[model samples]
Target: MTKTILITGASSGIGKETARLFQAKGWNVIATMRNPDSESELSTLENVWVTKLDVLDLDSITKAVNDGIQKFGGIDVLLNNAGYGAYGPLESFSRDKILRQFNTNVIGLLDVTKAVLPHFRQNKKGLIINISSIGGKITFPLGALYHGTKFAVEGISESLHYEVEQFGGQVKIVEPGMIATEFSGRSFDFSNDDSMVEYQKIVGALMGAMPAMAQNASPSSVVAEVIFEAATDGKNQLRYTAGEDAKMLIANRQQYDDATFIGGIKAQFGL
Candidate 1:
């Protein structure tokens, strides 16, 4: 049988690359994004369907899932890859921005998972792959809110596994370090307020280092490959860390105590 995978936020970056890789691997891909009309290349591929899906909207989530199942006969995997980074001092963030961040990154993820649960449960087989981040486990300056959401994802995925496994469904988390993508550029939202001058120096220093960090980062295709492996590996593994930076950081954090890890991170970022 030709298995299908429905991916959210598939317009660009990791989501986009993952869609392409899966299609190349002969999987039917439902590439859902906020603006499907704007996508050209993915729609041109065989066994690939580009549809509109906004994770924050329940109707869109349900429709995207149904559309994929209808077109591909059945969906074998669900990739929760629709999210963004909302970074910067928490104090600089407005109430609306904070809510939006959680809505898109955390709440939206839960809703999509809920929409797909019945299908997975009824079919007795499915894979849920969440695109979390190294930030989910470790924190950095000005990433409190972003890290909070990813941590929520980690906790949610861990708990969901116990329930889903009873029905032959599996949940996997993909934690990728800084990748060279729009995620570091246009996809990132940085909070800044001129009135909060006290935090400017640290914030500026972090922002200054981002371009250089991105230069040394891995490509989106690398993370895409990891996602593919997680989907097809058929192992009971709960987490897969992508990129050398992510592997090293996760290992280093695990080897050190909280204080030591915090100190190491601060020193690395020159804080």
Candidate 2:
């Protein structure tokens, strides 16, 4: 019997690649996004079940979970992949924007997991794959808010694993370093149009290098493969680091304590 997986943020970036890969592997892929129709390419896949979901919206998450359970017979895997980066100095970001980041990246994921747990516990078998970022493990300039949200995911995923282990449910987090995605294009509240005067000196330099960073990063395929491994592979580890850069990142963090490691990271960002 083919397994079924539900992937959020499936309209683009790593989520899109993951959806395509699972469909090819013969798993029933439920590709979810806030607006499914925005990406016509996803609509063409016969094995994919596209649904509308906004992570911040509880009604949408609950309804989508029910709809997925009905069609797929219960989701074997749930990929929490809907999150955006809110880059720039902490001072430049509004409280509302920071809250939005945490809501989608941290709380929204929890809500989705809550919606899907009953189904998983019923079967006593399921995998929860969370797409966290390397920023979760390491600090960087102009990414304090984004990193905070991801760090929450890292902690939440770690905690949930132990909580659900007895029930045969697993939670795994994927930490990817920068990847070639529209995150740069859709950087929430990190305005290219309006510069923050206070941090423009560094922010401008960082923005100028943003394009280079995207180019040096791995493609979505790197993250997609790691997601597949985390979902289906054995050993059931709590975390999977995606991409070469991410591997090096985890290594650096493990090699040094907080002060040294974080300072190294700060240096890397030219802060």
* Maximum-lDDT candidate: 1
For each candidate in turn, the TM-score is 0.98, 0.93
> What would the per-residue lDDT of candidate 1 be over residues 67-175, giving only the tens digit for each residue?
7788888889999999999988889899999999999999999999998999999999899999999989999888889999999999999999999999999999999
lDDT on C-alpha atoms for all candidate structures = 0.91, 0.85
TM-score top scorer: 1
Encode model 2's per-residue lDDT on 1-271: one tens digit a residue.
8899999999888999999999988899989999987879877887788999898999999999999989878789999999988887777667788889889889899999999999899889899999998889886667788888988899898988997788998988899988876455463457333555767776776776677667668999989999998887876688888888788878988999998987775676577
Model 2 residue runs over 4 Å out of place are 187-198
Error of 2 at 3 (Å): 0.3
Model 1 segments more than 4 A misplaced: none
Q: After superposition, how far is residue 248 of candidate 1 from its true place, in Å?
A: 0.6
List, in order, the clash count of every candidate structure. Answer: 0, 0
